[model samples]
Target: MSVSRCDIPLPENFRPEDILAFHRRDGERLAEQVDDHGLKKGLLWRGLPSCLELRFQPGAARLSLAIDGAAAADDAGRLASLGRRMLGLDQPVEAFERQYGAHPQLGRLIAARPGLRVPQTAFPFEALAWAITGQQISVQAAVSIRRRMLQLCDCRHSSGLLCHPDAARLAGLDADQLGQAGFSHAKSRAILALSRDAAAGALPLDAWLDGVPVEEISERLLAVPGIGPWTVSYALLRGYGWLDGSLHGDVAVRRAMQMTLGLPDKVSQPQAQRWLQDFSPWRALVAAHLWALLQAGGF
Candidate 1:
């Protein structure tokens, strides 16, 4: 299969590590799947033919981004719109900086990488399902379960690439079937419940966006049978690009924060909540940055 490539101006001071972290969270491990090479700023990947690649570059007044795929030329405008939406372009970074400035660690990191924004992933349902798959398990174990579930429920394109299983298809599954896909009882229940809700239009995954209040959306998300605080927060950050949402209960985030800030132990939930006061409306960016810090061995 022939490969194609393109580049867009990355958000000013964008770090490759941040993009790679977002891609990892999105379950797009092009680096692992393809024999490819390039800087994070202008990434290039070759995978199963016709794979989509997206990037964001910060601009003076707005963000500059690029999307490359066999279909990219036709989808440039849509891709650019998606990029703007994903990077929280609608929010003023200065506002976020003012609120979160008290945290020297977070502030320093942001300074080092100005105009840094959390890149959003496209697959919202997949993201929710993956979060459930990851609950209480090691990252490797989560990946294994996700692979099994996708293999059982997802269909491969003509080019041999797998797309996320559709809501209808997955909604047809029972707990037994999901368990066979390596999900535990709870995880299986959660995924099926999520699929059913999404399939029935109870949770309108597509319509949720940055303009919506994080707390409000999270409440609705929690109404789903298997969704919880962590899952809802994860979805907001990764699925909808809400810059102020934080995974306060997330073990990794807690650990990363403690280490980054030199706290002796993980911040308590209340403490985390208080900490978030410094990052309101941009807590999501702080969460992304902390996650990146963890990935980079800084925490």
Candidate 2:
């Protein structure tokens, strides 16, 4: 099959560093390892120095953008829209400050980080699959599992990008093969069930981002086999950009929040809910900021 690519102009302030930071936070580097599994590389179109090369696979998509500091004059409106969508410009920073003022530490920390918004990403399947790979495992072990899964199931695009396995591909695998790929029995069944459901159109994983209520979406996600609160919450934040979905049960998040808030011990779920009340509609962004802070040695 022939490959196609398209380029879109990015906003003037679309810094590569910012994209790198968000991608790093969402574990995009790990996704890259699985790119050759089944992802397809499409056409290459350029908008002169500020173009984005779009890649579309069966169940995932990503754009490789070339940041141009000098091309700001060419695509102002497009850039503005991109900026609004990506930088949380739609959110009122003042409102965020007003609501979170009681937790000065959280507010001050976010204020100091200008580019702390959760990135708009297109690969829900990749995000979900990664979350499963991470279940009850260390980050290093999760990475290894993901790498092995990709190696076992991935196909390469002409551009050498590794595409993650499609649902049909994964659904066809038996339990033993999945176990050989290092997936525990429960995880293997869950992954296969999700893949089969996705392939059969039973799960509208991609459509939940279109202004659906957070609780509704969370409930639907939880109905899937093997997906729990933490998985759904992570998906809400990473896949659909639901800012209010606080992942209170996440070990890393709980630890980070405790340290950041100077709590003597890990905050309980109820306490976390109360503490996170101020973040409200933008709690996901706050979580992203806290994660970044944790990674940077603040926690």
Candidate 3:
């Protein structure tokens, strides 16, 4: 195995642990790759097959690669690119703090957390499958199923790391096959539909949209069987890295908002939207902070 290394810089208020908390809600997340040190390692892509070990420093981020041979050498570039994208290496941390650091409610969170950035998946389909499978289920349960599904697809990286299932492989399968892997019938069909569209290049990934309204993107995604507002906002928030979205529809988000805001009952979806309006252009950040806060028992 050949090894290579790359370093990515951390922006102001960078908190590596916060990103880990957001991405790794449970220790057993099948699609997530984080070690005890918070270092993450996984394949560049299912096809590329190289494994990248990601470590973060206070001032910079480091990537270590283990490649099979010359065949996987070119994939190093792609590894770095994905690393940059997934880690939000270029996210404007101070800029957001400067904007919302003084807000009465969110300011407390900003002051408490300091630097928390929204995490994104290395692959869009990973988040898509997560969104659909996780519907009405606990995150821990969804991660468990996600792992079983990847094992069924055999999407392990060449360097011996688990990764999300590839769209092409999933697109060709029947619901029963995925069902055997622990997916609910509805989730299996939904993932299959999404995979089929994505594999056929019919579905649009976040990268395909530039300057597109968040609602418009949400509309396009709704055309898919299991895609919904929560999924769309989640995909945009954690997958696309868009900050102009919300987790209002999510139970955890609702609970977090209620507990934090001292609301007596769960806020309705529309009410959640109205509440999150003030955090426009950076609602995703608030979502990230809320998630991290919950994990930290900030409530």
Best candidate (score: lDDT): 3
lDDT tens digits by residue: candidate 1, 1-299: 33334344444544444444444532454221321222122212211223344443343222222323343443445545555554455446666666656666887766655666665554467668767887766676777676777668644443345545756668999999898988878777778888888889887776665356667778887887777887887777667766666677776777777877898866887787678666666766777667666663211
Q: Which candidate ranks first by TM-score, i.e. highest?
A: 3
How well is each residue in 67-174 modelled by candidate 3, as lDDT tens digits?
655545565676677777777765677789999889877788889988776667777777787788788887777767777776787666664666556678788778
Global lDDT of each candidate: 0.60, 0.58, 0.71
- When summed lDDT is taken over every stretch of 10 residues in candidate 1, the lowest stretch is 39-48
Question: For each candidate, what TM-score against the reference?
Answer: 0.75, 0.72, 0.87
TM-score of candidate 3 against the unseen true structure: 0.87
Question: Which residues of candidate 2, in runs, are more than 4 Å off?
Answer: 1-15, 21-103, 296-299
lDDT of 2: 0.58
Q: RMSD in Å for candidate 3, one decimal?
A: 3.0
Better of 1 and 2 by TM-score: 1
Report how far residue 189 has shifted in candidate 1, in Å.
Answer: 1.4
